[model samples]
Target: MTVRKVLIFGRFERFWHWSQMVLIIVLMFSGFGLHGFHALLDFELAVALHTYAALALLVLWLFSVFWLFTTETWRHFLPTGRGLWQVLRFYTYGIFRGERHPYRKAFWRKHNPLQALAYLMLKVVLFPLIWITGLLYLFYFLWRDLPHASDLLFAVAVVHTGAAFAILAFVFIHVYMLTTGHSFAEHVAPMMTGFDEVELTPEEEAYLEKDQPAMIR
Candidate 1:
């Protein structure tokens, strides 16, 4: 079988991807350790490790955002109402038939409508909620000394814990989704090699030709 390889991820993009993965894994483990999930890492050490990893991940996220926006790569995340249903239906009912994905990754667009929406929510709501809430919890003791601040400790902890678990859920789903591609490493290979092997479904290809003139051959 012949496969056409298209460059999907840039060098810096892969760097950001892998680095963020390592940091997030470290943070998750350390954060859970701090919560006494197990006696692996002591509370103090876990807190320190979590904080450092969080900071690094936050910096990496910021840099990625800046790069995407400045380079106009942000278009990849534009949520499209038209293809949303098609993408969802395909994922829900089509893949089991060895079906091609309803949405195809193009040169100008890296994500499909569904991926765009999911990623947008992760960036705007999920990650920010986790970062902000976690930050507040991290500084809870220091801020508690301020008048009326003590009342927020419980609230902040709840938000932080909730966001953490939400992110963990996303991580689990994300990993599973990666396996849905042509091969177990089909999707992940692009993240490392910066190239993706794209195969389009007939229905989606026909739709693209009729709707997206620029994308039609």
Candidate 2:
């Protein structure tokens, strides 16, 4: 078996990944403060910071959406459903017995079946819920002219808070999964350097070499 260092992640991908991670961390911190869960920051200060960070995240998401479509990198998140059960079993049971991964990374596909589905849901469902509810909560004043505005705002707040907690849970799981790579730094180093070392079978290597241009583009 031969291991090769491949440029799996591109420059923009690295930038977006790290930037989104930082923004999410800031949002989580400020969000908890606003929820009165802690006193790290004053209520007013926390509100201000949370709003700013959320807006910045929205902007980043917009640019990222455009980039994903233009580069067709969105294909990476498409669910193939193959080996989904095996992947889940590997994580839940097999990994404890030191079994190998059911799915391997490819030049065109970075995410496993479970990862692709989870990330797709995060982007299409969880994120939209939080963003839309946040907007309604933030601009309640403008919608106050409508009937039942107070109730609407309250519901939005409830959903937004719930989504925030869900995202926080996801963050914890994500951090833990980072250590599941070949080494502690194996998964993380690529995000910083845009390259990853992967072992490939002969057929896989041949396919990757032939499809390199399509993968990069």
Candidate 3:
């Protein structure tokens, strides 16, 4: 077995990735505690911490947007509905039978069709909905005297809470999938080192024997 060190993640990218992970986890714990999940942190303190963490995440996201545009990393996430069916087929049937991945990673593109779609929805739709509604709910008290503000606040709160749960569910699924790489920490190593190891299985080896290079360029 040979270990190769590849450049996977850059310094700022890794910093943002790990820092956001920590902040999100902290926010989740405090947010849930505020919802009466054993009261580890008092309601007031939880609210304060939640707000702080949310703001930090928002700033991190802004930095990420700038980074993506500057580095052209946004190209990696370009949604491709054309291969949606094939991606589903691979996940549902091909992988189970030890088939090769239909999608290949390149310098300009990192995600498969399914991954792009899911990530796009999560960022463009789900995250914005959560952020907007949460902000409105957070400042509801400041507008309590306005007409119909009460009803609007309640509605926004419901949406915010619902999105929060959905985000949590996505996190669980995302973490599990992260481990489905060349090895247990394969996907994880990329985030830490900025380079992912692309391996060829026995099936792929047959094709490589015909002179097709297996390593990703």
Candidate 4:
């Protein structure tokens, strides 16, 4: 019960969060336009936009991966089963009954079990699939004359589109989850302000007080 206002996200983490969203959103819009699902942009323009945004996102992902591992923040995405069922149950049944969220926020584990699992899938599965298929699709010009090249290109496009849809679905679900918290702002304030009400051990409190006093309030 020793909750304190602690710095859970650093400056670069906040940049990664917001910039990744913008890049993905741009990719989605231009992608759908390229798919002929919309007429908002010209085909050539859509291609340029999508390609540039994808490249930017790729660079961001590379730096983010490095930062996460170097900062030991990657542990936050390691899924655990201990509270997974309770968190799932709360979302499915208890939440509608006005039950408070079952998980506590720890500075080391900002994401709950289910949230961590989702993020793990996105980072390891969905994102890789999207980028791989996208690169293959984009560089098709080099392989245009290869055997069954047309077929390969179509297959790549299908897989790339499917992965994009999966990411779009994730965005919808993430936004919906934001509202499930005490308040929408409560869920969002931590990332924006870099401070969150999280439980701290006595040792952690003492360490922050002595080594990084500004990180705690």
Candidate 5:
């Protein structure tokens, strides 16, 4: 197999990823504090941090959506049946035996089938759930005069908190998957440097070389 350095991530994507991660961590801390899970900060301070972090995360999300559509990269997240079983086997059985990954990076596909499916669930389901519940909670005052506003607020809070926990669970699984790479840093290094070794077909190699040469190292 030929391994050559190819650009896989863009600068803006890198910025968005790390920024989102930090903001989520901040929200987690402040959120737990606000919910009386910890006394890391005063109530008012925790509320301020959580609110600001959520707002910042929302802005990042908007930019990411724009980036996804404008670049036509949303197709990358579309799930595929190909290689799902191999990837699952690799992680479950083959990895410990030191087998190569079942999926390859291509000009068109960067994520494996399972990863793509997870992203779909995150973007289509969890993110919207969290955003809607969170927004309703944040702007509760606008609907405070509704007949059962207090009851609705309680429901929104419960859903928002549940979604936060779901996100945290997803993060844990993602982090654990990082170690399943050839080396612990094999996956993460690409995000940091925006390039990684990929086995490119002749057509992809030729196209990147001719049209997007900067992507080939």
Candidate 6:
């Protein structure tokens, strides 16, 4: 199979990915401190840092949402029913047997069925849940006049803490999955340079050739 270097990520895509990664790391560290897991930062300082990081994340998300809609790259995240089982089998059994990957990367479709579903869940469900609960926890004083303010605040804190831990686990899993590519550099380098060496099927090659002029612009 001929492998070719193709542009997979764009400049803004790379920027958003790395910036989000950094902000999430900062948020996690300060969140742990605030939760009394360790004394990395003073409680008040941790709260301030976490709030700032969360706000920055929100800004990045807003920009990202606009970019996705404008570029129509959101289609890349739509889950496919065609290869879900094959992808799951490849991960669970085929990979151990040294079988080929069931899914291939392409310019229009970067994610396999499982990846698309996971990312969609993170963006549409987990992210919103954490952000909403975190905001509620932060502004508890504003709702202190409510009859069950104390209980409500406690519930919000619990949800926020739980979601933080869930995000932390996902981060570790994401890092581990990066090494599963052709080489660690093959996957990680594209985020740095916006190109990846990928194998193209005959149909994909023909499609690329037909759209070559548009792709260049």
Which model scores highest in lDDT?
A: 4
Comparison by lDDT, 1 against 6, better one: 6
Residues 7-57 of candidate 3: C-alpha lDDT, one tens digit per residue: 446688889889988987987898888767668897889989999998889
Model 6 / residue 29 / CA error / Å? 0.5
Instruction: State the RMSD for candidate 2.
Output: 3.0
Shift in Å, residue 15, candidate 5 = 0.6
Model 3 residue 134 distance off true place after TM-score fit, in angstroms: 1.9
For 53-166, candidate 1 gives per-residue lDDT tens digits of: 998888898899999999888888887897889888888888777788877666667788888898899889988988998878777777878877866877777777788899
126-168, model 5: which lDDT tens digit per residue?
8888888888989998999999999999999898899889999
Candidate 2 lDDT, 1-217, residue by residue in tens: 4566677788888888899999999999999888889998988889898999999999999999999999999999997778899989999999999988877776567788999988998999889999999988888889998998888888998999999988888888888888884776877888887777666667767766787743321
- Candidates' C-alpha lDDT: 0.79, 0.85, 0.76, 0.94, 0.89, 0.84
TM-score head-to-head 1 vs 2, winner = 2
lDDT of 6 by residue, 20-122 (tens): 9999999999998988899979898998999999999999999999999999999999978989999999888998898888887766788888888888888
TM-score to true structure, per model:
0.85, 0.90, 0.82, 0.97, 0.95, 0.90
Model 1 clash tally, residue pairs: 0
- Per-residue lDDT over 1-217 for candidate 4, one digit per residue giving the tens place of the 0 to 100 score: 4899999999999999999999999999999999989999999899899999999999999999999999999999997998999999999999999998999988789989999999999999999999999999888989999999999999998999999999999999999899996799998998899999989899989999899999999
lDDT of 3 at 191: 84
| Native-referenced Cα lDDT, model 1 | 0.79
Off by over 4 Å in 2: 1-3, 199-217
Global lDDT for candidate 4? 0.94
Question: Quick one: best TM-score, which candidate?
Answer: 4
lDDT of 2 at 35: 83
Q: Model 1 — TM-score against the truth?
A: 0.85
